[model samples]
Target: MNDSHSAELLRYAAFTADPAGGNPAGVVLDATGLDAADQLAVAADLGYSETAFLTPAAAGGRAFAVRYFSPRAEVPFCGHATVAAAVALAERIGAGELLFETKAGPVPVLVEAGPDGVLAATLTSVEPHVEPVAAADLTEALAALGWSDGELDPAFPPRVAYAGARHLVLAAATRARLAELSYDFERLAALMTRLDLTTLQLVYRESEHVFHVRDPFPVGGVVEDPATGAAAAALGAYLREVHGVQEAELTLHQGEDLGRPGVLRVELRAGDPRIRVSGTAVPIGPRRG
Candidate 1:
């Protein structure tokens, strides 16, 4: 590892209390001199879905402004990265409110130490909206995913859901169907590129308030995300809009197949269109360099 690689990288697993669970995120506490290319290189080297870069802010509110980068490219916003960044900041400054200016928009995150002294972080995304997926586009996506229309759940129709980033929401009729995730990566990546999609959110509803999800993030150069907070927020919005759930709190379980179990809490209020995702994060370890 070179000197640049030695630049402090904090690892955290977002959306889970255990380090072995949740989505792993690489966080650089001080990204003052790093350029876009350097950031991308670092993320690629880390081999995580996304890495967050923080630079000191001018207003002196939160210590730094944050940026997220996937292995292949820079995303507008990443919820897991946000959670990881917030938790990393909380470790140094104590838990409190953090305001982040992302490519998509401003995101507000609240961090606090739980009763058990574990750091918990909740991020409020930008206002979300649901749109109908074009029939032709759906056909292409289904073809790429090797899923037939019959396997889809009738209750949760296919739609493009956006909460900071766009994701196509698809519900499986059975949990077994959701577990088997074999898809054409190149084909799906091409389709997502054309559709401007971030990930394909595949879900199975266990109950009215409980769901299991898997996210195919081909665009981010990952076959499947172990845990995806952005897609979880989008899924919550889709459920609220289509199912008309009165209560705003919902639970999501993900990454079971990948063996990295994670839990995400989705909160939606009556008047608030923005979705809130809450989770606990634990540091993975010190940076390699």
Candidate 2:
């Protein structure tokens, strides 16, 4: 790794304005000097759920070719890290629209200063879809999670949802079931690997518009992600497909159970299949990885 390039790493907490209340991600605004291996090494060393690497886009102005890395592998897209990188860039370049060319697809993000003077970013996900999970695979997931069929909410059925990345969506029958999350990590990781999944989006509906969520990300080498933007986008797509929620805004409360509370807003618009996720991010002090 180039010492000077490594020195430019910026740390930010995504999904919340408070530095201590969101998911921390490592961001390299200019990763033109780093190779794939170097980026992976940085992500592993930082030990965040994911890190963002940005290089000038071939398309030019306000566009970047972005890549995301978890400790274990590179992901096509990552929501929280994208938000972190965008907000970080906005602070330097001023808030506006930015285009990110990701492996998944081109994701457009908008950053603006809110009335309170905090910068927040909204990212429009690539076309999303939900598919049924194989019965055998669902059984294996439930076994690995130590959850029984009866504990699952019948209304929300098990499905694999994708926005920027794939996540298995499982709804708990009760909030308590969602809160107590002790699972067999190795077993779950093996299952996730076979399914090509990034995380298990465990959720409980609090109301028609409010929900609480948690993500077990053994595949990323994290027991639990404090806040997951990719999963939030996937969940929004899942709800729209399963429940016909054509046009409405949804509120998601995450990281609270882990003591790093953060909020994610999911917007579904009429006639648009894409999902939008919005959140605020704050800079956390510099760190080496």
TM-score (all chains, Cα) for each model: 0.96, 0.97
Output the lDDT of residue 44, model 2: 89
User: Which candidate should be chosen as best, given TM-score against the real structure?
Assistant: 2
Query: Which 10 consecutive positions of candidate 2 have the poorest summed lDDT?
Result: 1-10
Clashes of each: 0, 0
Candidate 2 lands at a TM-score of 0.97
Q: 6-94, model 2: which lDDT tens digit per residue?
A: 54788999999899998999899998878888888888888999999999999899999999999989999999999999999999999
In model 2, the runs with Cα more than 4 Å from the true position are 1-7, 287-289
Report lDDT per candidate: 0.90, 0.94
